[model samples]
Target: MAQHPTDANVYFVPARSKAPIFASVSMFVMMMGVASWLNDVSWGKVAFFTGMAMMIATLFYWFGEVIRESQGGHYNRQVDVSFRMGMVWFIFSEVMFFGAFFGALFYTRQYALPWLGGEGDGVMTNALLWDGYSAAWPSAGPGQVGGHFQTIPAWGLPLVNTLILLTSGVTLTIAHHALKAGQRRALLFWLGLTVVLGITFLFLQAEEYIHAYSELNLTLGSGIYGSTFFMLTGFHGAHVALGTIMLLVMWFRALKGHFTKDHHFGFEAAAWYWHFVDVVWLGLFLFVYVL
Candidate 1:
C-alpha cells in the first residue's frame, strides 16, 4: 500500500484524472446553453438540456472516480488539507455569488425604487419613470420589468424549507460523526437519509415555485422584484440540487465501502459542500423571503 509520510498506516494518494476536464466541459455546455437562452435562440432548450445532461453525467462519473480512489487508499492527511481548502474557497465563491444578488436587491429597494417613486426630492431622468411607480420593496410597476409575482412569504414554505435544511444539516453532521467513528453502517444510513431529506426539500421548493408562478402572480417578468426573487432563490435552489447530488454520491460511496475512519477526504469534501449550501439557503430565506 502507498503510505503517508506523516502516518505510515494511512495511504497517501495522487490518483485522479478527467474530473477537471469533465467539469470544464460541463461548464462550457452550461454557458453555451445560458447564452443561447438569453439570446432567444431556437436551440436554447437543446443547449440547456444538453448542458445539464453533460453536467449530471460528469458529476456521476467524476464522483465515481473519487470513490474508487478513496477505496484504493490514495488520499492522506496532506490530501485532506487540500480538499478542505478547496471546499472553503468554493463556498467563498458561492458567497460572492449570493452577495451580488443581495447587492442588487439592496440597490433596487433602498435607492432606485425610492428615486423612481419621487421620494426625498430627487431630480433628473426619474420623472417619466415615476409617473405610475410607487416606492416599494416589492416593486411592481411599468418601470419595473416582470413586477407581478406576489412575494413568497417567509412564514410558510420558505420556513418549512429552512427547517428541512437545518435538520438535514444535523443529520449530515451525525453521518460525519459515524464515519469518523468507523461506524460504516450507521454513517451510510444517516447519509442516505440526509439525501432523502434534501430531495424532499427540493421537491417542496419546486412546488412552492409553481405556486408562486400560478397563484401568487410572481413571475420572472414581473419586474425587478420578480427578477431578484427568482435570481436569489433560484440560485439557492440550484445550490441545493448540487448539494443533494453530492450527498447522494457520498451515500453510494459509503455503501461501496469506500471510506474508512482514518481516511475520507471525499466524504469530508461533500459534507463541506452540503453545509455550505445549507448556510447559503439560510441567508436566502432571511434576506429574500423575510427581509
Candidate 2:
C-alpha cells in the first residue's frame, strides 16, 4: 500500500526485517571462507564464492525493498533527514577506516623504519638484530622479504586515473544540475559518461596491477611497501567499483522518472558517495603515488 504525504506528522515504522540477520550471516561466512582459504582448506574457494553470491543477492533484494518503499511515499521529511545523517556517518566511518591504514604507513615510514636502521634508541637494537641494514623508503625489511622490486611510476597510469576520476566528478556534477533543471536528456548523457569513465578507471587500475606484478615484481608479498600500497589502492578501487554501481542504479532510476527536482535523496546520496571516492583518490595520488 502507498502512504500519503498529507500525514507527514505520523512517522512511518516499517515491519521488522530479516535482512540484517542475513547480512551478518553472509559476512561471517565470507570471513570464515577467507580464513580457511588462507590456511589452505580445500573447499575454501567454493565457500568464499558461495558467501559472496549470497551477500550480493541479499543486498539486491534489500535495496529493492527500500526503493519500493521510497517510491510508494512511505518516507517523509523526517525519514529524509535520517537518511542524510546515516550517509554522513557512514562516510565518516569510512574516513576513519582509511585513516587507520594511512596511520600505519606513516608510522612505518617515520618511526619504525628509522628505528630498525639504528636511528635514535634503535642503535643497540639494530646491532643486535641485523647490522648494516640501512633504512630506505622502499625497503623489504631485514632479509629482503620478497626480493627487490621496482615501484610503479607515479607519472604513468596513476596520473591518468587521477584525471579520469576528476573528470567523472565534473560530469556527475553537471548531471546533478541537469536533473534539478529537469533536463532529462542532458542528465542521462552526463551520468552515462560518468559511469563509463568509472569503468575506464577500473580497467586502467587492473592494467597497472598487472604491470606491477608481472614486470616490476611488486606484489602483496614484496614488502611493507607492497602490502600498504596494494591495501590502500585496492580498497580504493573497490570503493570506486561500489560507487560506480550506485551511480548506475541512479541512472536507471532517473530513466524511469523516479526523482523529481525536490525529492531525490537517492541521487544525492550516490553523488555524495561518489564525491567522497574522488577525494580519497586525490589523497592516494598524493601520498601513495607522488610523495
Candidate 3:
C-alpha cells in the first residue's frame, strides 16, 4: 500500500543496507585493477572490466530499492527535504572537485611557468636549471618535455562541441518546461532530443581526441599542456556521458508516467545536473580550448 501522509507520526528509517559495503569493495577492486594495468599486468584489464560490471550491477540493484520505496510513497515531506539537501551537498562537492583541477591549470600557467622561465624572482633559479628558457602559454618546455605536438585549434571541433552542448542545455530546459505544463508528448520529444545532443557531443569529442593522438601527435604524455588538456576535457566528457545516461533513465521513466507536474523532483535533479555539465563544458571551451 502507498504510504499516506499520516501513516506514521515519525520519520521512516530503512533497515541496514549492504549496498555501501558492496560499492566499497567494487571500487577497491577497480582501483587495484587500474594500478595493475598501469604496471602492464596481463590480467589487469580483465579485473578492471569485471569490477566495472560489478559496480554497475550493484548500483542498479541498490538504486532500484530506492526507486521502489519512492514510488510506494514511503517518502514524506521531511524525506524530500533530506533528498534535496543531499543533492545540494553532492553538487557542491563536484564543484570543488572541478575547482581543484582548474586551480592546477591556473597555477601552472600563472606561477610555475614564469618561475621556470626566470621571470621576477626566478632569475637565479632559471639560470641554475633552465638557462635561456622562454615562457610561452603552450610551450613544451626547454627540451620539448614530452616531444613536440600540435594543439587542436579552438575554432575546430572544440567550437562545434561548444555549440552542441549549449543547444543541449536549451533543449533540456524546454523539456523541463514541458513537464511542468503537463505536455507529455512535448516533454518526451524534447528530452529525447537533449539526450541525442549529449551523445553527439561525445562523438565529436572522441573524434577530436583521435585527431590529436594520430595526426597532431598529441598524447597524454605531451608535457603539462597535454596533461591538463586531457584532465579537464576528459573529465568533462565523462560527465557528459554520465548525464546522458541519467537523461535516458529519466526519459524511460517519463514514458511510464512516473512523474507528475508537482512531484517531479527526480526529473528536476537530473536536469540540474545536466545544466551543470553544460556549464563546465563552457569553462573548458573558454580556458582549455580558446585560451
Best by TM-score: 2
Candidate 3 has which clashing residue pairs, if any? none
Question: In model 2, what is the error at residue 14, expressed in angstroms?
Answer: 1.1
Error of 2 at 55 (Å): 0.7
Give model 3's TM-score versus the native structure. 0.96
Residue range 1-291, candidate 3, lDDT tens digits: 334465546565765788999999998888888889999999888889888888998998898878777787778778778888988898898899899999999999999899989988889879998998888989776678789899999998999999999999999999999999999999999999999999999999999999999999888888899999999999989989999998998999999988888888888889989999988888998999888
lDDT (Cα, tens digit) per residue for candidate 2, span 49-101: 88898899899989988998899888999889999999999999999999998
Model 3: residue 47 alpha-carbon error in angstroms: 1.4
Evaluation by lDDT, superior candidate among 1 and 3: 3
Question: How well is each residue in 191-289 modelled by candidate 1, as lDDT tens digits?
Answer: 988999999999999999899888988888777778888888888888888888878877877887777787777788888888888888888888788
Q: What is the C-alpha lDDT of each candidate?
A: 0.80, 0.92, 0.89
Return the lDDT, model 3, position 92. 92
Model 1 stretches astray by more than 4 angstroms:
1-23, 141-144
Count of steric clashes across candidates, in order: 11, 0, 0
Candidate 3 runs further than 4 Å off:
1-9
